[model samples]
Target chain A: MRKQKRGKRTAQEKANARKNITKAIWRHRELYLFMLPAIIVLLIFSYGPMYGLVMAFQDVKIGVPILQNKFVGLRHFNRFFSSMWFGVTVRNTVLISLLMHIVCWPVPLFLALLLHNCVNTKLKKTAQNFSYLPHLLSVVIVVNIVRLLCDGQSGLINILLREFGKDSISFFGDPKWVYPMFVLSGIWQNAGYDAIIYLGALSAVSEELEDAARIDGAGKLKCIWHIQIPCILPTIVILLILNMGQMFVIGADKMLLLQTDLNIARSEIIDTYVYKTGIGGSQYGFASAVGIFQNIINLGLVVLTNRIAKRLTDVSLF
Target chain B: MKRISGERAVNMVIDVLLVLVAIVSIYPIWYVLIASVSSPMEIAAGRVLFWPKGLNLAAYRKLFEMPQIWMGYKNSILYTSGAVLLDLAVMVPCGFAMAQRTLPGRKFLNTMFVITMYFSGGMIPKFLIVNAMGMLNSPLAFIIPGCVNVYNLILLRNYFESSIPESLLDAARVDGASFTRFFAMIALPLATPIIAIIALFSITTHWNAYLGAQLYLYDPKLFTLQQVINNILSRTSSMLREDISIEELTRITLETNLQKYAVVIVACIPLVIAYPFVQRYFVKGVMVGAVKG
Candidate 1:
């Protein structure tokens, strides 16, 4: 009798909650109207594509409505698993992303640390302003500049190589050189702009703490190690979690520009592969399957990283 | 005395490294500028390094003669302006609404927007949707589909939530002013800095857009500036799958290298001119965004 009475009361409470929500909506009708446009736009643009992921299971005909198309259970995914392109795309994507994380991850932090130590305000501002310029340039322009600099025949690097005793390297043509060029040029382009977040965190470090360390006869480097780093560790943790989530979301646009017949083996990431086969080649179902594969892994990484970050450091994206 | 000298040495080292970093950052853009004016023969011969030899405006003259380049500029400018306005219109009011404590389903709406930042249906499905919507090969492809950037939306939301005081809202309520009036007359004015940052971000994003234009646009007349530049660069190179004779390829490549630099400079001119003026505000904007709500 007691349990039944409690359940009846909770059900009544749930009904009241629903009633309150409706009342609140009516009260804030103007605000709801304000949010309507964005909600509608997102539904059409963002969620529409999400809903279209069902095409991964369908043998989508060009003119047929998506639902009317024959549904093939996991056939595209199976075909993708058996294909030669699958290994190539996945390996290239994972390796390039991993390489970037390993090589390019600490560069901005290092840059921020160096800049934080600098006392001259004018020099600091000039360095920062110039550094941010590359981030503003389009990927197309940046890749064009990279090609000019690394051009096998007339590129400045090759020119310098020949002037010395070394043989000229085919930076674009050789698959071996692709990863370094990609990772290093990426650092050059983004390190300054990326450093801005760390710089912001560093600026918030308490001057009293630094002064206290200095009075203890700690050197500047020691102060940085003991005082500044500890203070900004939370920011670093949050940014790292965010970066991990983007591990599979490598810039496919850059890869497309960098790709050539000669270097496609190294540069054909999942995104470029989708563009090439799906849009250009019109293999819609297969490409959608491949794209879904990437999305699941990216989303999975984000969740896993957030969990780990929260457990270990008590800092998470959520 | 020893400790003081050590400190001086460290400071000197830091300054020197910073100066070097600045130089390295500026060098590529500088190289492109000089090469654009330098004689093609000098560039090919690797004689043009720091200075332009036999400098001339031949490349610019050739570029200006092309009607497609002019059309690209017009199309891009039109698209970017439309995009800025659309983004502000869609995002600002929505952000303000999201920040309101009394809004129904605020948690659900926030979650829906944030989920997009991490996951999506990827490129192929998005293309199919856009095609189905009849936006392919249309200028609306540039302006509409991507106008609602989730990051900017959250930035605006957080800015409003943190910066606008609860007392202000209560006072407005006491005055019997409606939410719409308070938003327009008070909240909108206070949110100008963030709104400007969003506009600046929208401008740069639309202007630099390459892949979307490449994917959706097929007509030469509708090509963006980046697409035009891409066409010029890829026409004579190994980047694309187009076939041509080796001698013809070399000839075209040699002719366009100087023009390539010119194309890059022209493409970046608007951003280069505007970035300095807006740099401080955007820097502050990023810092604000770093502090999560």
Candidate 2:
């Protein structure tokens, strides 16, 4: 009798909770109507493709209905793991990603700090604008400029090299020059633009704290270290976490533009590999498997880094 | 006295470094411009350094003669304008709705959007989906898919939440103004600066994008400016292959080299002219978006 009475009360409570949810939803129907278009778009474009990830497991053949393909149960992944291309592409991806982080990471922050320190407002504004100009150029134009500058026979860099009694380096032809060229060109293109985010953060740092530090005999460097750096540290950590999420997904567009028969060995990362096999060769299943593998690693890296960031700095994307 | 002098010295070092930064950043764009107007022969001989050895508009003339360039320019303008309009239409209402504290499932919607930023089904799936939709080889493929960028959505949502005062909405509700009226009149008007920022962002993205046009578009008639420029670049670069004789390579270089620089300058002219006007707002936009609203 006691158990039956308790069950009746709990059932009544569950019904009341459900009714409350429906009531709340009904009250916000207008908001739901406002969001309907975006919801429809995302469902068709973003979420629909996510559902298509099943093609990674299927033996997707050309001209066949994607859903009708037979499920291969990880066969493509097995082949990718045992393949020689796997090692080469994975190694190049990691090395290039690390090189990018090491060489290209701190530049914008340094540029921001430099801009922040500038006493002349006009000079700072002009310099900032000039720095941002390269970022406006398309990848095609930037790559073309790179090719023009590094053209072995008639390029500017080689011209200067020959004038100084040095050998002209074929930047595109040599495999070893691939990483440096990629990293350096990236820094050149994005440093000034990327600095804007940090500049925004720097501007938000409290002037009162800096004034206090200065009055207490703290030097400019000391004030920056104590006040400004600490204020912007959260932004730095957040951007770093975001960077980790994107580590595996390098700019395949730029890489494709930079790639040649000579430097393919060092330049082909997973994204480019997927592009070549999936789009170029029409091996959809295998390429999809490779892409899925890359995304999984990307997700894992982001989650792990987020956890670490949350523990250490309390600044996490989540 | 020593401390004051030391601070001056540091400021001097920073100014010099900043000047170097500006020069490095601007020099390549400058180089491309001067190279475009310089004589091809002088450039080939490496005589064209700081100044043009022979001033010429021949490259620009050659670029204008290409039918593909004209078509690309037309298509890019059409697509960019269409994309900006569509993006603003979808993102503004969605962001405004998401900004409301009274909205049901707000947290769930926010998470759904942000999750897309971190994880995606990869490129193959996206291509397959677009193919299935029969949007391939069409301009819709470029303008529609990937329009609702999650980061930008969040940025706009954050902007709305922070900038729009709760009292205004309360007053409107008390006066019995409909949600639609409040959004159309109050929210949209207040969001003009951010709307411009989003429009600028969409413009650049659409203008610069070629990979999608490469994948989904096959007809040269459908190509964007960047795609056409890429076509020209790859075609010429392939001629530099070792199989080609030196005379032929040099001849090809002389013809195409200046044209390449000319194409870059032409493509960038629109952006360079508009950048200064928009530069001031974007910094504020980034700041508004940077804050955890």
The best candidate in terms of TM-score: 1
* Model 1: lDDT to the true structure: 0.86
Q: lDDT by residue for model 1 over A1-318, one digit each (tens)?
A: 144555557777878767987898888999989988888888888888885578899988887987999999899999989999889999999999998886678889988998999988899889988887798888988998898889887777877787675899998888877788888889889999899999999999999989988888888888889998999888887887788888888867888898878987898888898888898889898888888988999889999998998899887777
Which whole-number lDDT from 0 to 100 does residue B20 have in model 2?
A: 93
Expressed as tens digits, the lDDT of each residue in B1-293 for candidate 2 is 99999899889998999999988998878888888999887876678777877999999998888999889899999999998999999999899999998886899999998888888887888898888889999999998997898888988888889899989998998999878899999999999988888888888888898688788899888999899988886675563568888888777777787787888888888888888887776666666666762
The segments of candidate 1 whose C-alpha lies over 4 angstroms from its true place after superposition are A1-19, B237-253
* TM-score of the second chain, cand. 1: 0.92
User: Residue B279: error of model 2 in Å?
Assistant: 1.5
Cα RMSDs of all predictions? Answer: 3.1, 3.2
Q: Any runs in candidate 2 off by more than 4 Å, and if so which?
A: A1-17, A208-218, B237-249
TM-score of the B chain in model 2? 0.93
User: Which residue pairs in model 1 clash with each other?
Assistant: none
Which digits, one per residue and each the tens of the lDDT, describe model 2 over residues A1-318?
A: 244555567777778767988998987788789888888888888887785578889988757877789999989999999999999899999999987875579999999999998998988988898987788788888888888788777678887788788999999899998888888888998898889999988988999989988999988888778888899987888888778767776857888999999999998989899999999988888898999899889899989988887898777789
**TM-score per model over all chains:** 0.94, 0.94
